[model samples]
Target: MSDSRVNLGKQHPAAYKALIALSAEVEEAAVTAGLDPLLVELLRMRTSQINGCAFCLRMHTRDALKKGENPDRIAVLPAWEETGCFSETDRAALRLTEAVTRVPDGHVPDTEYDAAAAVLTADQISAVAWPATVMNAFNRVAITSPYPVGG
Candidate 1:
């Protein structure tokens, strides 16, 4: 089969625009919920990583770096649980992001939800979830469209 694929964002501009609007809203919500901007980027990156969305991973990774996220933290993001680079809130957000990204694995388990609840307020938890949700949708679009990840 040919590698050619329709760019979903361009193929249906209205739907893509709606998604973009939702992303902007999510960003505002994240900020209003008192989530650190760096943490928001990390959540986006982690969700992209889990979905194997190279297009998104590259974008969010660059965003994270531009926000002054430590390179070491980004490097060890996949193994976040094993590192001391993240704070309690960061860990909670990461765990929730993973659970949200891997929903088909078994859905978000009680352990994950409870863990997040233990450290994050209701607003914070919702903030983490919305980014993960938006990232997952964007990942599906980019992956299905086979968005090019140029060097």
Candidate 2:
């Protein structure tokens, strides 16, 4: 399909605004919780990838790169479990991000939660969760709305 076919900006202004506002709130929470901006973007990209949210994947991949994330790491994110590109903290955050993003599978298994909790402080978890929740919400919105992908 042409890029204009998936252009969310032209298709639903009100819905887009609401999603933007929600994203802003989540970003504020992430900042307050001391989550690394790059990490947050990475998590968003990963979650978006899992949900097939092309718009988000495109947007966040650019954002992550602009924020100094290593392109090689981003390229290998989907295979993070098998790669050594991520740090311990990044691994924890990614695990939590996946769990929260795909909660219907089991609401984040104890092992995953424990591993993330062991590396991140309470505040960090809160911050990370907020972004993950917000991204998931937006993912649904984009998916259900059938939001346009480009242009």
Candidate 3:
């Protein structure tokens, strides 16, 4: 960790641009799917938390609060199942996010997908999955670079 790492985004500007564009498109799709802005931010923060991405967690946590996400919800995200603060839709998305983010531990299972599908429409499912998918990629990029947080 003592050695500085290359900024993959800067080293390959085109790839970073592509990822940015993809994220924009995915975000628009998620919005079009009628995801609550706060919910989306919550999912983003939760995925980042599971990935141990400090940068993402800090950024998304701030964004969530700005968008009116509950502080208690944010605080208890890791134990979401133990709380009744979230809706069925939110729970499904969180579950799906965990499944997608933890793919190395176990391939995303059909049961998880089915559970999400049960509570979410097709587009909503895609909307949730895409962010989790992209966030995983972005998490790796930031973690590899060990992006600094705070001013």
Top model by lDDT, which number? 1
lDDT string for model 2 (1-151, tens) is 4443454544777877887898888888778877778889998999999899997788899999999999999999999989999888889889999998888897889998898999998988878887888888778766765456776
Residue 91 deviation, candidate 3, in Å? 0.3
Candidate 3 Cα errors over 4 Å, as ranges: none
Q: Residue by residue across 33-115, what tens digits does model 3's lDDT show? A: 98887888888888889989999899988988887888999999989999999999999999999999999988899999999
Clashing pairs in 1: none
Quote each prediction's TM-score: 0.96, 0.84, 0.94
lDDT of 3: 0.90
Task: Report clash pairs, candidate 3.
Answer: none
Q: Would you give me the overall lDDT of model 2? A: 0.84
Off by over 4 Å in 1: none
- Worst 10-residue stretch by lDDT in candidate 2? 1-10
Single out the weakest 10-residue window by summed lDDT for candidate 3.
Answer: 1-10
lDDT (10s digit) by residue, model 1, range 64-100: 8988999999999999999999999999999999999
Please state the error at residue 108 of candidate 1 in Å. 0.8
